[model samples]
Target: MDTVEVVCSKLVEDADKWRAAADGMSKAADAAGGLAMGAEQFGKIADERGVVSAYAPLQQTFTTLASGAATEFAKIADTLTLVAETYLREDQAGEHAMRRLEDRL
Candidate 1:
């Protein structure tokens, strides 16, 4: 028989860090959105189409990337937290079972 040990606390700690990263990404997404708004306003006053054309695509791309990164980071954080919780629950259940078996002896 082999024994395996899992550091569930470590998993949860890592999940918290991932969640923090997600928060940062969300802030970036907000910043990108703000820039897009400013660019839209500036485009209205600009005489040339080149500046507007260049910034429009860039704004859209940045907003999309930031939003996507936030979503992915959040998913990673959630998964890590869930894995840690599940492991902890199962370990407790096993311990309880062992205690019950010992009580029967």
Candidate 2:
């Protein structure tokens, strides 16, 4: 039971870290999109026709992929938190029942 608690605690900690990482990923995606848009306005070469236009699809795709990855990370974090909470609840309940039986004995 002690071991289970320790494991659950670790799971919760990992979940928190994952949540933070997801936030960072989302922020990075936003920043990247902004940079790409800015570049499209200022970084065009005359000879390289259609180069700026080509970047539009790439930027959109990158942003979409990053957003999806962040969503998955958040989902995983939520799942881990739920699992840890459930385990802790069950452990406490079992301990409580055991104590009651011991008292009767």
Candidate 3:
């Protein structure tokens, strides 16, 4: 669980960095000359690219989070399953012991 939390935190940090990169890209584009399509097309592409780039980070974050969560959940599930099996075996043994005592009486 602690590891999961750390991974999640790291993913968030990466997301922030990705966002900053996209923003920087947008600003640089804005500072450059007008679009070749008489300004309108260029402006549109720039705006669209900025927005699209912004989502790129979000998409990456989602993918990372999802994959990590799945892996962690699998591990947790395996642990729980092992615990359950152990308890079940113990219970079965106890039941058998009790039955044997009853028969001896």
Candidate 4:
């Protein structure tokens, strides 16, 4: 037979780590948002070769990518937190059941 143990504390710790990463990504998103705003400045009609339209396309792209990544990371962190809490509750219930069984025996 094989045995396995689920450490709820470790899951919570991992969730914290995911949350930190999400925060970092959110900061990056904010910075990218500033860049996105700046990108609008490049859409002038300076030359016929379209040299002035370089960064205008990125007026929404960079911010969207970074923001999406941050959102996904946050979701991962929330899922880990939920899993940890659920496992902890289940473990406690199982332990209580075993104690009752032992007391009756």
Which regions of candidate 3 fall more than 4 Å away from where they truly are? 1-44, 47-49
Query: Comparing 2 and 4 by lDDT, which wins?
Result: 2
* Model 1 lDDT, residue 96, Cα: 96
> Candidate 4 residues 1-105, lDDT tens each?
322135766777888998898898889889877764332454434434564454556746777888888899889989988987887778789999999999999
lDDT of 1: 0.84
Better of 1 and 4 by TM-score: 1
Give the winner by lDDT.
Answer: 2
Q: Which ten residues in a row have the lowest lDDT in candidate 2?
A: 38-47
Q: Candidate 1: misplaced stretches above 4 Å?
A: 1-6, 37-49
**Of the candidates shown, which would achieve the greatest TM-score relative to the real structure?**
2
Q: lDDT (CA) for every model shown?
A: 0.84, 0.85, 0.54, 0.75
Better by lDDT, candidate 4 or 3? 4
Better structure of 2 and 4 per TM-score: 2
lDDT of 2 by residue, 1-105 (tens): 568789999999999998998998899789767866534474657326766667778888888888888899999999999999999999999999999999999
As a TM-score, model 2 comes out at: 0.81
Give the per-residue lDDT digits (tens) of candidate 3, residues 19-103: 5555554444443322223325346667666755565465555555555554554455455455555666676798899999999
| Residue pair clashes in candidate 2 | none
Candidate 1: pairs in clash:
none
Q: Rank order by TM-score, top first?
A: 2, 1, 4, 3
